[model samples]
Target: MRQTWRWFGPADLASIDDVVQAGAEGIVTALHHIPNGTVWSPKEIAKRQQLVRVRKDGSPSGIEWDVIESLPVSEDIKKQKGAWRELIANYKESLRNVAAAGLEMVCYNFMPVLDWTRTDLRWGLPNGGSCMRFDINDFAAFEIHILKRPGALEAFTPAVVEEAARRFAALDDAGQKQLARNVTMGLPGSTESMTLEDVRAHLAEYGNISADRLRQHFIDFLSEIVPVAEEVGVRLGCHPDDPPFPLLGLPRIMSTASDYQAILDAVDSPANGMTLCSGSLGARPDNDLPAMMRQFGPKVHFLHLRNVKRDSDAISGSFFEAEHLGGDTDMVALIAAILTEEARRKREGRADWEIPMRPDHGQDILDDLTRRAQPGYPTIGRLKGLAELRGIMTALGHREFGLQ
Candidate 1:
């Protein structure tokens, strides 16, 4: 696998020096300055790539912009309502521009309500720094108590609702505000943020769309755009729902293996594939990460590697970001499977077959505190993750080659 880091462009607090130091040879970024629903000109893509290339510290030896983490999907496109034709047209144009810059894969998501939910952004770890995580009880409190969105309690069981009420009542005003901000505010790559009023307005946009309706809209949007992606040699890898469930009175369709299958079957093209985020899908016990790797191996063009410790108590459980080798996901076996696929591609003389993988969400630790980096994207944590994964890969590769 070719290791890459997700950089939020030049203005990001984590500089190109930080990415190179973390040992990533490739950069996963986007033209975030370009507004949603607007076309990205080739000039803009080249300019951004140049900035990263020049700012990198290692004699121009590190970090080339190779993949776009996203091209924001317009709400009009998501709703699949009026003006969708124009939105789809703009998306296709953007894909062509990205491809013209020689980028191969574009990672995107079609989740309706939220991109990824975290009850706590700086959820503390015993090891020192923090990691991003979602807690059902904390989220429940946000839905049923804080936001007080009607019918929000219906998504949870009776027991969960009662617990949520208790949790809500227990929190001080400041704590409740933090919970609301944590749930509703958009993080990086989410494209939009919401105030309490903005959230209600956003919910109104999805008034009649159920899960099925949302799924159909995604399918339709992909049907129009994937063909263009194929023409431009850009693989469109859709990221999974973060918690793998619905939240905030919105419908979530791409949260399971079957959901992935439905997407590939709907588009039925190599251009339409999965990003295979372990942290996102691994939050749910039912998602067998290894089995998913085997099943989707042929179609996976991108990867997000991070592990979570699921708690037995369910409601009270908090996910601590574990070391790449320490988590419940069995990442060693997962990486071995991916390498096996890469070996098969090599034997067949296929170029560009090694999937581009990245250590998904990292802990905010050490020197990263002095920098303005995004939470969970701290330099030291991901550098540690990449080092661990690299060591595992090296041992496996040497053993396969009979090297002592």
Candidate 2:
């Protein structure tokens, strides 16, 4: 795996120096300063790439921008009815520009309304850092009690609805405001912004579109672009739906193995692939991470590795970010599967098989707390995660290949 870090460009609190110190040789970033639906000019892409590659000794080692975390799909694109042709065409042009600038992997998601959802941004960990997590109850409270969109109550049980009402009632005005922001505020890479009205409007766009409809929309979008991606030598990896389920009455299409298989079958191109996020799929017990890795290894172009602890009894279980080797998903088996795939690629002489992997969703710890880092993207916690994963991969390599 080629290790990389997600940097939010120059304005990010985590500077390029910080990324180098964290031990990644590659950068995963987007042209965030550019608005959605606009083409990222090759000049802007080169500027960002130059900034990321400058070494501490002031030499340019060409630390490349290997992936675009996302090129946001405009609201019109999602609806597939209004101004979508223009947005899709612009998106393809952006892909060409990025490829022209020498980046290959482009990661994006097609979730209808929201991206990743976290009920708490500061879930305390035993090891002194705080991790972001989702609480089912908190999400329910947001949907049923706060956002209060029509038919939101149908998504939860009666008990959950009652509990959500109680939780909503307990919040004073400030607390309620914070909860709204925490739930609705678009995280990095997601383009959707939410006021209560905006959330309603977004959901309404998906009104008649069932899960299959949304999936078709994604397939249509990809069908138009994957050929272009292949022509430009840019691999487009679609990130799975976080939490792996429907929320707020919106249909979630890319939350399971079958969903991914459907996507690959629809596009049937090597450029169309999966991002394979462990934290997203790990939330569902039925999603065997190791098995999925084996099945999708050939098509996975990127990886976001983090783990979650799910509880059957608790609707809102506490999830503290664990060391890479400490999570419920067997890190050993997962890495072994990835390594096996890499070995296969090597044997086949495929140059692009070493997928770019990053430690996703790190805890906010140490000096990171003092500085204003993006939520779940604190530097030290990710450094710890990267260090741990590196050690595990090393040990696994030795055990599997008889290296010292």
Candidate 3:
């Protein structure tokens, strides 16, 4: 795998120098300032390409843009509502522009409303470093009391609902407001943000959209864009749902391996692929990360190599981001699968044999506590993750576990 880093443009707390200092070979970013549904013109794309490849002193950064973390898909496109046609047109044009700029690996998600939900952005760890967490009771509290979505309490189990009520009761106004912000405030790198009212309205619109309906919509979306991607040599990878389960009463279409397989089969094009996000899918213990990697490695266009510690062995439960190797997903086994796949591709002389992987997220430690870097993406934390992952790759590379 080619080591890469995710960099939010200009406004990111971490600078290009930070990425270079961390020893990333490539960059994963997007034209975030451009609004969703608008075509990313060639000029705009060129500007970003220049930004990634150049430094303030006009010297080479030695890292070029390797992947587009996301090209935001609009809600209209997801629901196939008014102006969706124009939105798809814009998307196809954007895809063409990106490919024209020599960026072939692109990642996006079909998750509705929120990009990725978490009840706590900075939950403290025993080591004093903080990481993001998805606490089930706190989320249920948000749904039942904060957003007050209709039929929201019915979604959780009885025990969860009771605990959620207790949790909600304990909150003062400030606590309640903070929870609301954590859950609904647009996360970093997300396409859109929402107010409680905005969320309620969006949920109402999706009230009738079932999982099957949403799945079909996603297929419909890929049906339209996949061909354009194929034509432009762009490989589109759909990111799986974070936490890998339903939330806010919204249907989750891409949470499991079967879910991904169905979408891949429906689209049936090499351009149609997945962003294998270990942390997101690992939140559900049943995901079987290594097995899934072996099964879908050929179609994985990009990689987000992070891990999570699920609270239970059940299918859907609370989980917190874990250290890259310390998490439940068996990092060694997963990366071995990736290397085996890469070796196979290399033997076949495939162009895209090596996947671009970034240390997706990390715990806030050391100076990270004071830097207050972007939530989940701190300089030192990610550098630590990258170093750990590199060590794994190097050790595995030196040993023989059936690599050609």
Q: Which structure among the candidates has the greatest TM-score?
A: 3
| lDDT by residue for model 3 (1-404), tens | 99999999878888787788888999999888888889999999998888888777788898899999788889888888889999999999999998998999999888899888899999999999999999999999999988888898789999989999999999999999999888875646654678898988877777768899999999999999999999999999999998789888788999998999999999999899989999999998778999999999889989999999988886758889999999899999899999999999998898999988999899999999999877899888999999999988988887564653
Assess every candidate by TM-score: 0.93, 0.95, 0.98
Ranking by lDDT: 3, 2, 1
Against the true structure, candidate 3 reaches a TM-score of 0.98
**Candidate 2, which ten residues in sequence have the lowest lDDT sum?**
312-321
By TM-score, the better pick of 1 and 3 is 3
Model 1 vs. true fold: TM: 0.93
Residue pairs whose backbone atoms clash in candidate 1: none
Clashing pairs in 2: none
Residues 1-404 of candidate 1 have per-residue lDDT tens digits of 88898888766777788777777878888887777789989999999888778654436744688788888788778987678799899899888888888887898888775667788878878866677777787888887776778888788878778888888889999999998887766657444666777767767878957888888899899989999998989888999987777777787777789999998998998888989998878777778888898898878889999988887435234465666777779887788778887777677777767889988777777876566367677777788888988887788778655322
lDDT of 3 at 141: 92
Best-matching candidate per lDDT: 3
The sequence of per-residue lDDT tens digits that candidate 2 reaches over residues 256-327 is 899999989999999999999988877776788989999999999999998777755342343445556676
Error of 2 at 316 (Å): 9.9
